[model samples]
Target: MTDAADAEVRDGRDLYVEHCASCHGAELQGQPEWRSPDKGGLYLAPPHDESGHTWQHDDSMLTDYITRGGQAVVDDMNVSFTSGMPDFGMVLTDSEITAILDYIKSTWPDRIRATQAQRSQDAWVD
Candidate 1:
């Protein structure tokens, strides 16, 4: 298997650390009490780790969330929940967003990754 040091993996790690680590945790642990809203009523960034629901979403949903911001994406899906994630569409290229997502997925356990991949495929089929 290719090592984590591969160019895309390295770039994904670097980009995630620079852009997403602060809110999401350097290790993708997310913030404390992430399920609950903050003092400002904003949901804290959720973990991208196996413990979180990030794996439950497909790639398109994840990409849309990163690119369109949580609110807009949620709005598009008519979801009732509020999303605190900011849209990175204007600031980052599609490739960059994909890189970050690749980094996030790289951390998941094999089972979780497989499940999530299935979800992504199912979403497209539906």
Candidate 2:
């Protein structure tokens, strides 16, 4: 019999494949040398694994990231430039976004999950 956690992992994998794997990578490993600057000059794709900064972000911010994509602000100007990331708000429903986030959370270790929970609570207030 498959473990419940295993099932959850499978669901997460499905979500990742349908929504995130395009840029984030097929294994949640993110792009190559994701932490380093790439030819485009920005960091490629940072890992969402425990080694990544995803744990440092909160749910609210994560939600915004999925909804708004990434914007470049220079000298107080907001330029609606295309980012490596896309806004999933249109392509995927809120529930789907939530599922994607759930999948990410499911992959995290306990300590990271707890920290991210705190970050989620603090996510836009300060």
The ten-residue window of minimal lDDT in model 1 covers 1-10
The CA lDDT at 105 in model 2 is 83
1-126: candidate 2 lDDT, tens digit per residue = 258656656776798898788778776778777766666766566677887787787787677777767542221246533346666777877766776787888888898999899877776567
TM-scores of all predicted structures: 0.92, 0.76
- State candidate 2's TM-score: 0.76
TM-score of 1: 0.92
Candidate 1 per-residue C-alpha lDDT over 1-126 given as tens digits, one digit per residue, 9 for 90 to 100 = 377446777799999999999899999999999998777777889999999999999999999989989999888888777778999999889988888888888889999999999999999999
Show pairs that collide, candidate 1: none
